[model samples]
Target: MMIAIGYMLSWRKWFDEQSSRLIAKLVTQIALPAYMISTITHDFTAKRLLSTLPDLRFPVLSMLILFALAAVLIRVMQIKEEHRGLFESMFLNSNTVFIGLPVNMALFGNQSLPYVLVYYMANTTIFWTLGVWLIQRDGTHKQAFSLKTTLEKIFSPPLLGFIVGVLLVLFHIQLPQFILTDCSYIGGLTIPLSMFFIGIAIQRAGIQNVSLNRDSLGVLSGRFIFAPLLMTLLVLPMPVPILMKQVFILQSAMPVMTNAPVVAKLYHADEQYAAIMVTETTLLSLAVIPLLMMFVKSGFIT
Candidate 1:
C-alpha cells in the first residue's frame, strides 16, 4: 500500500521528517488544487454547482452541532485543560480533504467529487476560523486574529482551485485541452502523496506514543460515532441526492484534521499530544472504513 511504502521509506532512511512536510506542501499547495480544478470542470455544470452550494448548509449545520457537543464532551471527558481546545477541535473537525477525498473517490468515483468539495468548503472554512482559535486557546502562546492570515488560510489553494473551476463552469469558459491534461497529471499526485504523508507522519510521530485514554477515545467517538450519526440523521430526512448523502456520511467519519499537530505546535500547545491523537484517529479510520462502506452499501443507512 502507499502508506506502507511511505512508512518503509521513512524507516529505511529514505525519508526524513522534512519529507512529510514537503510532501504535504506538494499535495496541498500544488497537487490538490490541481485536482480540484480538474475534477470540478470535468464533472460539474453551473446548475449543479448552484444546487450544491445550498447543500453546504448540511455540513455547516452538522459541524455547529458537533461544536456544541465538543464543548460538553471535553468537560464530561475531563480532557486535560492544556489540551482541551485541541481535543474540542479534533472532536468536531474531520480530515475532509486528505483521507476524505481519496476514500470517497475510491468508493463512489469522480461523480462524488462535487459533493466532496461541498463538504471540504464548509470543513475548511470552519476549521481555519473557529477550530484554529480553539487550538490556539490550548496553547500558552496567544495570537490575535489576523484577517490577512485568516483569509489566506480560508482561501487556501484547494478552495481557490475549486473557485476557479466553478467560475470556468459558471461563465462557460474552457481551458485548452493540453492545459487540462497538464492539470490532470499534476492532480494525479494528490491521493498517493497524501497517503505517503500520513505513513511518514505516523512513523516520525512514533505511533508508539499514541495513547487510548479519555482524550483519544472521546475524539475517536466524535469522529466515528457522533459525526456520522448526526450527518446521517440530517441528510437522510432531507431530499438530497443519494451520492451527496453518502459523501456527507463518509466525510463526517474521516479522521481528525492532519493539521492538528501543526496548529498545536504553532501555538505552543501540546503538539506531542496532538500528534498522538492524529495518529490514533487516522489509524483507527483505516479499520473503520471497510465496515463503514459495507454498512453504507447494505442500504441500512439511507
Candidate 2:
C-alpha cells in the first residue's frame, strides 16, 4: 500500500524525475546499512550466529540449484541470445536487499534480520559472480570480465554493513549509545525510501507497458512460485527453525532484483525487457506477499 502510494505520487509528478534514483541511492547506501547495523546488533548475539551456521548453507545451495534449473529452462525455452542473461538473472537472483529486507522486517520483525542476512549473503555472492557474468556474457560489446569489479560489487555498502554488524556482535563490541540511536532513526528510512523508489520505477517504466507475454509469465513463475516452493521442499526436512523456513519462503517470493535493468543496461543486454520484468514482478508481489503470508500464518506448508 505504501509502495502504491509512492508510485501514484511519482506518476503525478509529486516527485521529480531525479527523485527515484536519488531515493534508490539513499536507501541502498545509507538508510539500508544503518538499518542493517542497528538490526543486526540489537537482535543477534555471537552464540546465536554460531548456532545458525548450519542453516545458512541452504540459501546458497538453493540459489545454485535454481541457477542450474534456470539454465536448463533457458535452453529448453530457446530464449533468444539477447534475453538469455536477463532471463537467467530474473529467475536466479532476487531483490533480497531492497524489497526482501523491508517485507521480512514488516512480517517477522527484527528477529528476521539474521535469517534475512543469511539469504542476503548468499544472494549477494551469486549475484556478483554468476549474475554479473551472465550480463556480461550476453552483452553486445562483450567486455572481458574483471575480478576487481565483481569484488567491488560484492562488497558494496549494504553487504559491508551486514559484515560489520556480524563482526560487532561476534566480538561483543558495543556501539556508542548516541550512535546506535542515530542509526536506528536513519535506518528507519529504508522501508519508505525503498517503497518510494519502487513507485518511481513503475512510473518511469509506465505501468501500462507491462506485458503478460510468455517470457514475463515464465519469469514470474520462476520467481514467486517455483523458487519459494523449491526452497520449502529443501528446507522442510531440515531441523532449522520454522521461522527460518518462513523467511526463506518470503524472500524467495520477492520481486526480481531491482538492479536487473541497471545491470542489463550496464552490460548492454536487453534493458527494456529487464525493466519491464522488474516492474511487473514488483507489482505482482504486492498481491503475492500478502497471500503467501496468510498461508504461512495458517501453517499450511509446515
Candidate 3:
C-alpha cells in the first residue's frame, strides 16, 4: 500500500526529468557512497567481518539457483537467442544494495544491516565478473573484462567506501557526533531516491515501447515467485539463523534491480528488452513482495 502511494506520488508531473536525473546522480555518486562508508566504518570489527563473510554464502547460492532457473526459463519460453542475455541479467540480479538495503533496514532494523552489506558485496563481485561475461558473451563490447575495466569496477566508489570503512573500524577511529548525525541523514535518503529513480527510469523508457510479451512475463513470474519460493524451501531445512533466513527470503523477493537496464546498455546488449524486464519486474514486484513476505513469516511454505 505504501509502495503504491509512493510510486503514484513520484510519478506526478512536478517531478520533471531534469530533477529525476539529478536525484539519480546524487544518490548514485554521492549519497550512496557516503551511506555505505559511514555504515561500514561504524560497524567494522573482526567479529562482524568474520560473521558477515559466512552469511554471504547463502545469498550467493540463492543467486546461482536464480541464474539456473532464469536460464532454463529463457530456453523453455523460446525467447530469441539475441535477447536471452537481457533476460538472464535482469532475472538474476536483484538491487541488493540500492533497493534491498533500505527495505531490509526498514523491516528488520540495524541487526540486519551487516547481512545487507555482505550480500551487496557478494553481488557486486559476482555480477561484475561472472554476470558481465555472461551477458556480453556475444562480443558486442570489446571492453568487457579488460584490466582497466576490472580495476575501475574494483575501485568504484561503493567498494572503496567499504574498504575505507573497514580500515577505519580496524583502527578504532571515532567519528565525531556531528559527522555521525549527518551520515544518518544521508543514509536515510537511499530509499526515496532509489524508488524515485525507478519511476523516472520507467517514465524515460516510454510506456509505448514496453512489452508484456510471454517471455518477459515468464521472467517476471520466475523472479518474483519461483526464486523466492525456492530460496525459502532451501532455507527451511537448513540450521541457519532465523534472521539470515528472513534476509534471504526478503532479498530474494525484491524485484529485478533497476540497474539491470543501465548495465545492459553499458555492455551494448539489448537495452530495450532490458528496460522492459526492469520496468515489468519493478511494477509487478510491489504486488508480489508483501504476499511473499507474509507467507514466509507465517511459515506457510517454509
lDDT (Cα, tens digit) per residue for candidate 2, span 1-302: 77788878987888876777788889989988998889889988899877776776888888888888888888877777778777887897888977898888888999888888888888887888888788777788677778888888888888898888889999999999999999899999999888888878888888889898667877898998889988988888877788888998888888888878888888788889989999899889889999988877787656
Which residue segments of model 1 deviate by more than 4 Å?
A: none
Tell me the RMSD of model 3 versus the true structure: 2.9
Pairs of residues clashing in candidate 3: none
2 against 3, candidate with superior lDDT: 2
Q: What TM-score would each prediction reach against the true structure?
A: 0.98, 0.96, 0.85
Worst 10 residues of 1 by lDDT: 293-302
Q: RMSD in angstroms, all models? A: 1.0, 1.4, 2.9
Q: Cα lDDT of all candidates, in order?
A: 0.89, 0.85, 0.71
For candidate 1, write residues 1-302 as lDDT tens digits.
Answer: 88889888899988897777789989999999999888889988899888888899999999999999989988888888887888888888999887899999899998898899999989988999999999999899988899999899989999999899999999999999999999999999999998888888878978778878888899899999999999999998887788899889999999989888899899999998888888888888889988788877888655
What TM-score quantifies how close candidate 2 is to the native fold? 0.96
What TM-score, to 2 decimals, does candidate 1 have?
0.98
Over 4 Å off, model 3:
1-18, 40-46, 138-141, 207-210, 299-302
Q: Could you tell me the lDDT of residue 136 within candidate 3?
A: 80
